[model samples]
Target: MSDIATITAAPIGSFTAEVFAAHLASLGDAPAWWLERKRAAYATFASLPLPTRTNEGWRFSNLSGLQLAGFKVERVDPNGQLLASPFGPAQLNFINNTTVGDGAGARAELAARGVLVTTLSAALQSHPDLIREHFMAQPQKLGSEKFAALHAAFVSDGAFIYVPRGVEVPAPIVITHAASGSGTAVFPHTLVIAEENSKATVVDHFVSVSDIPHSALRTPQFACGANDLYAGHGAQLTYLAAQNWSRDTLSFQFNSTVVRRDARVQSLNLHLGGRQARHESHSQLQAPGAFSEMLALTVADGEQEFDQRTLQIHQAPNTKSDLLYKNALRDRTRTIFSGLIVVDSDAQKTDAYQSNRNLMLSDDAEASSLPGLEIQANDVRCTHGATSSRLDPGQEFYLQSRGIPKAAADELLTFGFFEEVLSRLASEPLHDALHQLIKTKFKQ
Candidate 1:
């Protein structure tokens, strides 16, 4: 059975040279170095073994559901149109895996303030030094090395934002990564660098272009993605990611965040779709007073399963980190949240917290939470917890007594449960937009 799963996921025909060659041929005037990197990445992709049940990081995940057979990396659907962002802020729209149009609109002032918000490929040429310094510099220390290798092998078109020293952008630089056709594989990458004393927001949106049409036969939406964020001394960066793939998609996204002296970084990942999805996040607080806030929200139903693994490393004195991940499970859906915090021996006064909470909406649903901490600093303040719970029957009844439908009542309570986390977003517009997005997701 495991071999069969591997056959479905590590398909033979999909990783062929002809397919990769065609992808490279389409990239007009690509740099030689990047091409070489991709070539090396492809070799790594082929050599790496498929993650099996024996892998400790993949524990509690349904390995058989990870199927990549019949998938191919192809050109975007030429005939398909991309959907607009539902609630408008600053928008960058990608149609058929290509960023078709983008507009800061009223937020154009951000560009005037010495902020460079452009596609990663564009940024590579325009701001080579910064991209060279930060892009994928962190090693894949997490257990998703295979997926990271695959992402490196195929990644194209993603956003790269650089905020100069002491410049603060009022608006979020939004990036949308849309996968259009079935059996179509895309690699989306994002790199964010906030210089010292700068403040900015970056949002990455991954969605299936339901309005698009596929021109080819036997295609699927199979994608691998990665995002790297660097916060310089005293800089503040906030990142929001909303991932919604098609039901038939197999997806993996790896996120690496590095925080420097006195810098602060807050990131939230929201997962709403995909048949099988795995997200790995790693944060390293590398200097004194650096802080990181990691948050995620997932809605799983219809046999969907989300596996998340996270690590918070405190490498310097007085650094801090707090992680809060909440999952609401319905039907036979399952979710796994495993997180750890490690404090170095010299990192005295380190403060870390990790919490995973689950709200069960169906009797058959399952949610697993594992929170651990390795504190070598005896003087540090560290805490970790996991709570698996159900909707409060009283709370449900209270809403129902107001003539609310049971489903709506449950949803309302679920929203209340998530509101605590959403409230963490300091941006009012962003908070409201994400809240409305979740509400719309529930309606669907």
Candidate 2:
């Protein structure tokens, strides 16, 4: 098997054909079908070119900062402790795509209750059929198909959760993906399968260990991650992802959600770190009475850029989807939000709404929004809108008159603005934890 040094001379970044061969060799005794899938994914990744400024899907994105070269894939030993989360005890931690810890002490009980929480590698061997059925099954309708293929080619292990029918997990399952070494590239995958009438919540945290200082020549890190959420009939699934990579990391996250008959899925993403980050979310209501609620909050500061793209497809009649994305931009940061809602010809009585709101904190910051809708059914009700605004001077003055400092007043106002999204969460603890995470980002 070839190592990183041997493949560094190849032209296709660190993910050369030689590197892919070595990756396949590392997965000893893997099934033939899975291996073939990886080979095909790598081929797809290699054939696609990087996105250019002319691409409509990548409009207003900082295409110059996008780089697929110079990053190496290597396992990093845990150097420091993983950040603690107040969510619950069921947690899995990974450093450089290698599982380091599994804290699900309630595993036995969960297992008895027909809940399966394990690493992707383990699930591949133990539950091959389930893994094959839903792993990266959704198409990359939004942009970032190349990155998604790269993730599938290089992904080794991640969190895999399966909740059987009628089982309701009492607590949220937490998964942490941490990058440790400089120039290290990690592919994180999370697949949650909630069977009919089941209920579960999964939270994912992406962080960098021993983060390098922003003043120094920051080493470039790469993180390409994806998650698949499947909610069966009458099932409920709630997913929350928090991304806080290092200051120099280039991050890409793709989410695909499938809501079946009478099922409901709610997903909220918190973007707080990385020099350049792109997130694509696609939610499909495949059956009647299905509903999807998509929410996101981004804090872009100090030259950071966050690009978000979303698509809501109503495939069946009486389906519903609602999307609300808000961003707070400061300094010279930039943010882009592009979203579309599609109602199929047979999807009558569909109700869909999309909104993008930005709060500009600095005159130098830039925020771009594009909201659109495609309705083939006349009975559907769909609406899309975008708005960019600054903090209200009256609210600032009112807070100042109440003895709050200028900075404190601004923070309070921002929190008040964000509370609209956070209040939707049923778990108050998770909401508070996310609120504190946003506060910490402001201090940095």
Candidate 3:
């Protein structure tokens, strides 16, 4: 049998090749220009080589295991359960890469206001214009172009959210993606566009339907995905994402948020699974008064490794961006966080801050942080800092004195430590939901 290790050459006529071909053929006859763009993107992807140690954006990233040597993308069958992962005032679910659960006449209400919430495939057939305008619109310049290309090549389904101008969603929207098969490869994309003066909150959850053994694994599937957030003038957008892929898979996620004039955008990502998972996020403050807040949390256990990199660019004067990422490492796991803040020459009065803090739960775990800044505007205030340390023994002891077990004490203290970031979530239900998810992590 030919194994992944022995496969050195790319096979153009493989099953995935046919799958990609079918994707192109089934496009409901899109504009020639769009199809041409897809062809161009595929060509670019096939032409670019994987990142190496010398690449600055990939520095400190574990790249050897990123080989496309194994795995084939396929459709996941019917699966998923109504997991009660702390719900907010509203909820939406995506089970096994498909939509599920309709609550509170939500679909009708959104439709009434011209807000369209539908599957990516359905939207591809119905709202081709929207997809044509914003699908993978931004340049993938963050050094993850290879994975982004893979996502574009194989992606067939995802969530499409379009908030019309001046519409304000009263409740937060929830989306969940769960894997069911033993060796499943799923690609989930979320594209959200908030028009002028609109407001919306979207929470995305990625989970596994079954708990695969981490220490003993057979086939290691790959998870390649992307998310895009577009906010127009005076708009407000909040996104909360939790990634809980199968414990033995390779995962890559690239997310970008574009903030327009006077727009406010906040995104929070939580990482907890996969043998080797790398996440990259980029946010651009494109105009004056634009603000962005980025928050991320990771819990690395066993031999798992979570690598994360981020960038915040103040492209216009008086723009602001604040980033805070926290990680908790247990067992012999490893994590790396390298981030940067850039203040352009025209970005006068730019206020940008970048911070990464790690809480070590075991002596064998490792956490690395590198924070930097490039500021060309003399009048801007830009700062970056990275810190890695163990849990505060004093705080642990204080909780223990109150009759809490040592493990419980440590968990409680850790939760308190993360509250500062979680509290920033404007939705109470989302904050509580995230708190519950973190609580379950300590029990594992």
Candidate 4:
């Protein structure tokens, strides 16, 4: 193991050199390789500067709202409080970077079938090879490299899931990450690996818990999270992430997906919280017959700002990828959607589509879209577009005339607008769960 003294001392944001040392000390008897990786990641994070206005990757972003100071990493007790999930007993709950519950009995059947569901700390000691192979394996191409490195440096424990070849899991594994207390910072991660011909579903819930009343002062928090999903040849994987942090929190999430030959992967993200939140997703089609479907829905209200960026890369011939993102902006909120699709020279017969749609509910709201395509292959069929529109007065009036109040009418219209993306889900239960969550946000 590398000596802690060998690492140079430096501070970035509220994460100081002392903080990093304390975090390392907390991980008693961790593998040497993992400890060394954290040291290097911290070095990289300190050397890199925060994103500025001149950075093209952060265009139209509220750069001033990207504050990382005044936060500390600490263990928070949830006072016997646990948020309920809509799905099965296969659930893991974490509060303030500490694991509070693990549904072992609920997962016994799947475990007997060669499925692995455990914390990253446990996986580091047992399945070291798998952890080393797929943990943040992809490069940070979406321009949050600094924050991504910081996450790698400070991440303590997260969920790890592995499915062996030809095994099928019937229930969706749920992982919940909650941040409690003011000025608290938490790093949450989930890594999923589905072997050849295997099948599985995983859902992640990001939320906040506080004693503060909703109408009173809201808690301030910081959350930096990332996830990696890999589907082996002919495998099937479905992943969903629901983020509902405190309204005064600042959040960042990065996602990377890899699909192998004849494999299929689908991911849906629902964003409904945070004073300012940014999400980046990248999907790579690495083999022939591979397919990826990426979908997201965001509800930006008040002065909230939701920034989303995505990339679809076609690395092999005969690969397909589809991405659709929808955002509903109300009050004086803002949203930015920037996406690009890249087709390699050898990736002929590639079929790719990208679209971003925004529904404006207030005249003061702002929506910005930047969609681009870069194709080195001449035979590829790729399209990209973005549109921003408001609710039609006729439609709103028609619903109101039928005895529905204006607020109820608007809620109904918004659900109608979001159905296109929700209807694509293969599981009706998951779809309804997400629908109910979004409806709760509307009511708030």
* The candidate that achieves the highest lDDT relative to the unseen native structure: 4
Tens digit of per-residue lDDT, candidate 3, span 1-444: 233223324422132456666767856655566567667766656666667677888776676666665565555445445555455423456654556666437767888888877778777778888888888887776788867876776666788899999999978777766666555666788999999999998878877665444422333567777898999999999998888776778888889899999999999998977889999898999999999999998888888999998989889999999999999888999999988888899999999999999989999998988888888999998878888888888888888888999988877777876887898987787888788887777776
Give the total clashing residue pairs for model 4: 0
Error of 1 at 132 (Å): 2.4
Model 2 ranges with Cα > 4 A deviation: 1-11, 211-219
Worst lDDT run of 10 residues, candidate 4, spans: 1-10
TM-score of 1: 0.93
TM-score of each: 0.93, 0.95, 0.90, 0.96
| Model 1: lDDT of residue 138 | 85
Worst 10 residues of 2 by lDDT: 1-10
Instruction: Provide the RMSD of all predictions against the true structure, rounded to 1 decimal.
Output: 2.7, 4.0, 3.4, 4.6
- lDDT of the structure predicted as candidate 3: 0.79
Candidate 4: tens digits of C-alpha lDDT, residues 1-444: 122122223236688889889999998878999999999999988897777667888999987677677899866666645667655443678888888866877667668888988889989999989989999999999899988999999999999999999998977988888888889999999999999999999999998876664621268899999999999999999999999998998999999999999999999999998999999999999999999999999999999999999999999999999999999999999999999999999999999999999999999999999998999998999988999999998999999999999999999999999999999999999999999999888777
Order of models, best TM-score first:
4, 2, 1, 3
**Best model per TM-score:** 4
lDDT by residue for model 2 (1-444), tens? 133333323325778898888888988877889999999999998887777656899999887677677888866666545656645543688888988765767666678787998889989999999989999998998878888999999999999999999999968888888887788899999999999999999999988876454531255689999999999999999999999888799999999999999999999999988899999999999999999999999998899999999999999999999999999999999999999999999999999999999999999999999898988999988988999999999999999999999988988888898999999999988998899889987786
Cα displacement (angstroms), candidate 3, residue 344, comes to 1.7
Sorted on lDDT, best first, the list reads: 4, 2, 1, 3
Higher-ranked by TM-score: 2 or 4? 4
After superposing candidate 1 on the true structure, give the runs of residues whose Cα lies further than 4 Å from its correct spot.
Answer: 2-13, 77-80, 87-91, 104-109, 212-220
